[model samples]
Target: MAVLAVVSVAGLIVDDRVLVGAPIWAKSLKFSVSFVAYCLTLAWMLQFLTRRRKLGWWAGTVVAVTGAIEMVIITGQVIRGRRSHFNHQTPFDSALYNVMAGTVAVLWLATLILAVLLFRSTIADRASARAVRIGAVLGLAGAGLGFLMTQPTPGQMRGTSDIVGAHSVGVPDGGPSMPLTGWSTTGGDLRIPHFVGMHALQLIPLALMGLVALGARVPRLRDERIRAHLVAVAGAVYAAVLALLTWQALRGQPLVHPDGATLAAAALIAAGAALGSIAALRRPVGGNRAGTPERTRQPVG
Candidate 1:
């Protein structure tokens, strides 16, 4: 994580010249910084998920190495004024791109495996466990969306085989985009849901932590049963929102230019979240234990 942070800072300090498509350094810089935080957070969670110390170490090592390689390739391409993703212009570039794809595949598999292990095992903190489980599921779904970006859109391959499809739906790749992130403002950008889904690992856990803090201050909020229900409801709502964004993008609608359908979907998601929260407050949180009832455990440390 420290190494990635240094790379991120260097990327920011470098010249902001456009490379093959966009401001190359900015993309690398942003991803590097965000990924650094992501890696550390995942590592922290993995510790609580498994009792096998060596297995945890190995998993973390693989993630660190693959992530660093990914960052290196992206930054390296930026320095060469070339596109790192979907660049099949030359044999060398294609090989580099293929390597990155493999690295990400491995990382994804490892993460999914860890998530499975987490789900099968019992953790001390129900709230945190639920958060991790939900986060992993959403994160994988988001990563799966990357496959859509790789396929060539109809008519996109007619002009140039060097480029396949794009993250944008109606807009061409490298066309008019949102500031900094470069998501299409005129059309659906698949990256929107992809980005949103990937961060569930962090967001869901953070939400649970916030609840824990609130419980610390408010006497009524101190019940673990209620906290567990709240966390579960929050996860459900988060997943629903993620699904809504994906649906919006698939319908070829830009996030900023939501149509009536998008508005309606958003409203439905909000209402569902609100109702779920209400139900959580009214129900016994720890009563359900994989269909078997267990006495409420002590509050998690």
Candidate 2:
């Protein structure tokens, strides 16, 4: 992870010039940093899942190798002064793109397997367990959205272009973008949901950790089940929001824009998720505290 972080920084410096409007290595740098963070978060969650079984080592290895392959392809393409994604300019480029896509598919499969393991395992802190499970599920959903980005836009299919798709809807690729993320500011960008969904592994667990810390400071929140319920609710709502974003982008609506339809949908999703969470809180999944050993119990953070 540390090595990847260093490589990400080096990419930013080496490819300082703008290639397709954005810095040449911008995508490479972003992928590198995101994967590094991903590796750390996955390793942390695996610690819990692997306590009873050793399958985590194999899953982690798959994750590490896939991530490394993706970074290599992205960085290699950037260094060659071409787009890393959606490019089919040459036979070699097409093959490279397909290989990277295959690697990502493998990574997602490994993640799903690990998530299932985490869900079935018994843990002292049910809250952390639930958070990890929800994170893994949402992360996979987000990754599934990547397929939408692979399809060509209506206009692109009509043209004789090497690349089949573009990230931006209304705006052309390599046009105006948001600062660090390079997300389209002038048009709907499918990458928004992809980015949001990919980070659930980190965000959900972090939110749970925050609750755990707060519970330590407050008397009423000492019950780990209460924290678990809250985390579950947050996860539900987070999933709804990701779906909403994907819907909005598909409609060619920019992230900053919110029409009456979008606002109404968001409100409905929030209410539905909240109601679901409340119902689940009443019926806890794991048995009440008796099975969990004292040595196994620890602060979620």
Q: Please, what are the lDDT tens digits per residue for candidate 1 over residues 6-104? A: 765676677667763566576676778767766877777776655565665677678778888998898888878888888898999999999998998
Error of 1 at 43 (Å): 0.6
Model 1 regions lying over 4 Å from their true place: 1-14, 51-53, 284-301
lDDT of 1 at 253: 86
Alpha-carbon local distance difference test for all models: 0.77, 0.80
Compared with the true structure, the alpha-carbon lDDT of candidate 2 equals 0.80
RMSD (Å) of each candidate, 1 decimal: 3.1, 3.7
TM values, all candidates: 0.90, 0.88
Candidate number achieving the greatest lDDT relative to the actual structure: 2
Candidate 2 Cα deviation (angstroms), residue 163: 0.1
- Among residues 3 or more apart in sequence or in different chains, the pairs in candidate 1 whose N, CA or C atoms overlap within 3 Å are none
Candidate 1: global Cα-lDDT? 0.77
lDDT of 2 by residue, 99-153 (tens): 9889999998988888888887776687777888899888888888888898888
Please name the candidate that would achieve the greatest TM-score relative to the true structure: 1
